[model samples]
Target: MNKLLVITVLVALLALSAESFRVPRQAAAEEEEGTLARITDTVKSYYEQSVNTASNYLESIKGMKLEEKAKNLFEETTKAVSTYTGILQDQLYHIFYPQN
Candidate 1:
């Protein structure tokens, strides 16, 4: 009867240890999934902001009267697009080539 009790305690301890290890693994997977979801949301927001900015600029240009003013708007839009493109390219490059 004593030996049976010892065996039962040992089995219970091992089962508890196994469960503890499994819990951390499940928690780690959940944490990783949440991190990925946040990253995806951030990237989506960045693209939406970029799109909205470009659309607003285009809408503003649609009401111009003077040729000189239109030309200026065109130049400004070109500069803005170039800047945004450069930033996006850099971001993509960094994502593909993370050092750590």
Candidate 2:
């Protein structure tokens, strides 16, 4: 009877130690899953927001004339280039012939 009692106590101690180890592993796994779920939700939200922004931009430009847009863009580009060229010419002239 004494030997049986000893064996039962040993078995109970082993089971308690095993349970201690198992609890942390389960908790870690649950935490990892929660982190992954949060990352997935954030990525999905950003993707949806990007899609909505693109849809809104397309809707805003849907009725515009492409030819007129192109013409205006070209005019703006030409004016910018002309201004840059004039500034460059003035710098070169000053560099070659410095004023007194």
RMSD of each: 27.2, 20.2
Candidate 1 lDDT, 1-100, residue by residue in tens: 8546655755554454343334453355444444445555565566567769989988777755467887999999999999999999999999999978
lDDT by residue for model 2 (1-80), tens: 85466557555544543433344533554444444455555655665677699898887787677778999999999999
Q: After superposition, how far is residue 57 of candidate 2 from its true place, in Å?
A: 18
Instruction: Choose the strongest candidate by TM-score.
Output: 2
Error of 2 at 91 (Å): 0.2
**Estimated TM-score for each candidate:** 0.34, 0.37
TM-score of 1: 0.34
- Model 2 spans > 4 angstroms off: 1-63
Q: For candidate 1, what is the lDDT?
A: 0.68
lDDT of 2: 0.70
List per-prediction Cα lDDT, in the order shown.
0.68, 0.70
